[model samples]
Target: MISNPAKEREVRPAPPDPALDGLLTLSSAQVLVLASGGCHSGYAGDLCCCLLAAVQGALTASSYAQSHILAPGQALALYQCGEFSIQSVGEGVCMLVQLQGDLPGRLLASRLTDSAAFFPRGGAAVREAVLSLSVLEDEHALVSGTAASSYAYTMLTNLISGPSSEAVIGQGEPLSPLVEAAVGIIQEEFPFLEGLDELAERLEVSKAHLIRTFTKQTGISPGRYITHTRVEYAKLLLRGVDPSITYVAEASGFANANYFAKVFRRETGMSPSEYMEITPRKEPPKRDPFLW
Candidate 1:
């Protein structure tokens, strides 16, 4: 038995519909389970092929795992004390189906990139959801249909095959549907925002690409989008007290009162004071001494 025991298992998360997911599924795999156990049992085990293809989401074992590719007519006579999973379409051993024209490493990187915004700290929510789901094993029927299906699967390939740490993303790099989907989610969450680099880091796309794609897809640059949203929000505040021109500048993200005054005049075509004056006076605003 090994001192620090390990477990062996195969995991496949596929969806039924290539339209929704599982666009380009992996090829079938004929897996043999062999174990020299210090975990499930203190005994050696024999190797066996799953008599049939069973595409499954989660396979749990209390022992370490390893598998080898096999051509037809090949077999192993070995043993394992733990469990394993297999995906096959016939009585023959399985071959993992790589996506058509898919580059595994780049595809995987694209997938992980989708969660870049919350990665290292924020991906727990998505990871948990992925871990809990089982459809990722069901719909990989090996053929992708429709242009959308092909596009989606291409992205999945990018994810399962992670990019090198220093990998450069070129126009040649495979893009994933998940990447675009993640960007959409980020925009919705922080419509009026700063710290774009942090946000881009979380989204997992390069800051440059994020900027370009967002503008191409949405017709507005990221910085402009945030500034416009912030300015819109400031208008709501302007309807209240804190009508001082300097105060409005500070509250509206102007670094200096003079700068804020300039921007406010440009955006609204009037100074903050002038805007406040145009707004009808209501009842006297209650003030706190702390505010003064």
Candidate 2:
């Protein structure tokens, strides 16, 4: 759990997902569980085959002029190229599984549209399988490709056609018009703005009401949303040629570099340099690909 003095609110993280309970049973595939923040966006232009599972938190994806919000226990399968934006709602984490082998593109072609994109239930076993593969990779300090292709194919078949697709898609509770406006304001002006009191004043609402309303609808306070937006901005800058961490910090509107580093590490498990080193300068072919 983490606290934000900026809003005097405590963020009690939800229990970790148990989707990986069968990780040891997984026989094929190489997987990795990656930590991600509540807000971010990107494009995936050349991904061929991959699965994305949301073990924790809610994820909203928009592409092809359509949008889908994936609740916990849901997975999204992808097998083609397109630009997409995946945003974590509140505090969340996702898993990525790069299935080995030459996958037939049309294996998933029938269910690739927005209406058929998300698999709503039975995510735990799949998630655990990926975790098991990740453990194997970590133990060896190398990825073993032997028999991985068979395993990846099995995982995909199970996720797509193993069970009847009767799971209900999730939709967030709609925000009141005022609360929606507040969110828009924070997102638009956060880089140049600070604190929620001014925002509340501008909206003519009490700070307590503003905090309560926003948190109730989004599960995070307005102050924290601003922080997320700023941190997300820093992530984008760090991936680019910002000259130095100080420059990135300033660009993201942080008061100083040291503070920025502390918050960045806490929110995202890695420091800016470590993130830059591991994250490709160019967005990878797969963006958030791991599903149940």
Predicted model with the maximum TM-score: 2
Alpha-carbon RMSD, each predicted model: 23.6, 16.2
Model 1 local distance difference test score: 0.34
- Score candidate 1 by TM-score against the native: 0.31
lDDT of 1 by residue, 1-292 (tens): 0011012223333333433222232232223223322111122223211211111111122223454332221212112223433322233212122222122222333322211111111111121112112123333533222322222232232223212211212244444554444333332333223446866777777888878886665555665655553354345335443344554454445566787667767778997678778864322212232132
Span of 10 residues, lowest total lDDT, candidate 1: 114-123
1-292 in candidate 2: lDDT tens per residue?
Answer: 1111121111111221233211211122322222354444434334344456654556776666577787655777654435655677755555555332233244565776642256665343244345334444545654344323323444555565554212111147777987877865654344456678889998999999999988887777778777776776566545432226775676566778898889899889988888888754422122124322
Could you tell me how far off, in angstroms, the CA of residue 213 lies in candidate 1 after the best superposition?
Answer: 1.4
TM-score of 2: 0.41
lDDT of 2 at 272: 85
Error of 2 at 216 (Å): 28
Error of 2 at 113 (Å): 1.7
